[model samples]
Target: MTGFVYSESYLNHITGTGHPESPDRLKAIADHVRNSEYWNSLKSIKPNVISTNIIQLIHSGSYINSVSEACENGFPFLDFGDTAICRESYSVAKLAVGGVVQAVDEIFNGNLDNAFCAVRPPGHHAEAESAMGFCLFNNVAIAAKYAQKKYNIEKVLILDWDVHHGNGTQHIFDSDPTVFYLSLHQYPFYPGTGSKNETGTGDGLGATKNFPLSAGSGDKEYMDIFENILPEIVIQYSPSLIILSAGFDAHYRDPIANMNVSEESFSRMTKIVVKLSREVCEGKLISVLEGGYDLNALVSSVEHHLKALQGN
Candidate 1:
């Protein structure tokens, strides 16, 4: 199997107690990666620092500055509801963003065939100006813009499989034709945005595809959509690269959300995505870990996710 990239600072370790988004989630991932034989495929690497100027490619100064201010003034909630920040949160979030950007660069430069970012403060729910659902920075979006600006790649595909819709990601790219945002998640959930009719608008019309399955939808329904819809739309778009907002909270054992996506589903799903990347983009794929509350489920699912990613 081809070697991959990961990092230790991905283990930021400072959210709050039993806060659905806790450090333990990443700790479990780190521990498993260390114990598993598959760990050999992953080498620890540092992010190539992209400046605030580079970050501005996706986020506004106000949003970036405000989060920094909140970290300075003291820990305050960043989300409208659940997300919060402590003193170290800002620094750790930087590492998280760095991890994604580095993963993007490594894949684009052929240092690794593909990479999975094991960082936290997950980014899909983070928008251009607001942080929501535990996300402080839009990691995947920043990578998308970096790819477009630096590589001159015209089309990038973002696939959100987080059990909840990536309203923030969609809103950020809804008007841009150069990026395609596709989400397959539970309908009528938190942030409540994805729907069958809520496809992309303006120049991005038909680019944003949503498959909002019912609350109890399990591997069967999820797999059905992936086999048919995901490949068809993505192949049509013919993305230069595929970025995954990979969230494991959809697993049946997760405490926060209740979709029945098991560990096997994660591996199988990754297999399909890799298949698409191979077919069209020569396998330029990068995945960033997102929302997953249950520690056991998160660990198990992420392990499966990486195994499939490594073609192990």
Candidate 2:
């Protein structure tokens, strides 16, 4: 059955008012999920606090220390960057990573058909040694590494449909052929990393696939790309586990990004992923929340996404 990982501590990673990545994002989704009919059927799991040793799988030691010290000293922001943090952010970020890790473990252990992590301080923009873009650690990236290290998974597929490209994730596994990173995002946008030509490097060449769409691209365009490319890539890669950098910011109502993806589109896209997992990996899949600014849209899109996850 489809399961979910959550923690009230996630709300402690506050970014202040007017900040797009606020605590309410997760709160809205959590409340909606609990009130839904599927609540009784969905397994609710609490994530264990992860070790710094597990974090070292993807982040450098100095960077980890710096983040810890910053949180301890109560630095306003990790850098003179867009990412913001408070006293509890360091621990909360670690918990966010833990949530994804727990999802990976459950899926691999046959306790769940799939899982979703409603986490905060999104991680796609975080690099191996730095925290930026409202992120501390690259949660999904770490989960991918965890799957490889702990589970002996041979090949993993990461599908990111966030409005913005997952630069950190792409770069992390860019030179490793074992992980295939595929992203569909708005081109010529923030952080500006994803491009058609920037496939991969060295042994990882062609393992990374990017489909950069325009700002106004909507459901049809997104689905067209998915139908054309996603299935073919899944068949070619034959991933043992599929991880999603699932961000709802692409919704037309989202404040931070420009895209026209609707609630229905998210379900359709999710159905595609679900079917792919069934074909390629016995339905082993996990989605880690990335970005979504609008509360109502985030909540509704997540409901649709989970409904698809539950095979509803």
Candidate 3:
């Protein structure tokens, strides 16, 4: 198996000074992943930039142009207070999307059983046509749709266990039942979406599941929910491929949000998801980093995450 990592060389230009979602978030995780024993189990590569058409699969041309435009002329603050763009934002965002795509390539090519793309600015917050929540593009959504278009997989399973709900991802696929979107997040959290009642709509109805926990939720709450909800959903759906929205902001030490998840908590949650992938997707899984603010938590949590990915 391979755990693909992108250098912070690109991320350096994606954020503003004093940003929580800054490039250092990725650097910390990379250092942890590479220095660990699990690094020996992984083949490493820098993620490439995505082609324009590849991005157009889920994002509209206008939205794509907006990002490109932002890249050319310095940058613009994304929307409200969610995200920012800079001269190199488009390039790095494409690299993030390409990281997931390349992970899919490695799994499909049989070079690896699975991968974890340690990339940012985190996705799951970027909608189809909008760049928000520090995300310039929806990397997971982009990779999922790319898998379908390129492989005719028809069904993709996205497990987003970020402390905050994956509102953008849920929004893009809410009406498209071809994908099963499962998310567990803190209730009344940022972006204020992903309520239990926000199950898919129309043909997509019942194809989505959201479990919103209270603040201070920890491993016990997470493990309990996964054992009960995750298994039933995966068995019923039987997805051809699985993608993980791995976010570490849930760690107890994170400054941006309140959640009782610890480093060991990340390890436990990752192990649960890995087991499910083994049963349903033939171990075909690609994990992409979404959000994790605390440097130490990010580093330690990723080390834990990669160990589980290595079957340790």
Best by lDDT: 2
Q: Tens-digit lDDT track for model 3 on 1-312? A: 756667666555557778888887777677777786667778896787668899898899999998788679875676765677778777788888888898888887778888888887788988988888888888999899999988889899999988889988999999889998999888988879988899999999987899988888887898788777678888789998999999988888989888888888687777877888889888889999988888988888888888878787
lDDT (10s digit) by residue, model 2, range 1-312? 988899999999978878888898899999999988889999998988889998999999899999999989988897685779899999999999999999999988999999999888789989998987988999999999999999998999999999999999999999999999999999989879999998999999999999999899999999998788789999889999999999999999988888999999999999999999999999999999999889999999999999999887
What are the lDDT figures for the candidates, one per model? Answer: 0.83, 0.92, 0.84
Candidate 1 worst ten-residue window by lDDT: 1-10
lDDT of 1 by residue, 147-214 (tens): 88878888999999998899889999998998999998888888789988988888888888888888
Provide the global lDDT of candidate 2 against the true structure. 0.92
Error of 2 at 302 (Å): 0.2
Ranking of all predicted structures according to TM-score, beginning with the best and ending with the worst? 2, 3, 1
For candidate 1, what is the lDDT? 0.83
Error of 1 at 198 (Å): 0.7
Candidate with top TM-score is 2
Query: CA RMSD for every model?
Result: 1.5, 0.7, 1.3
RMSD of 3: 1.3
- Tell me the spans in candidate 3 whose CA falls farther than 4 Å from its real position: none
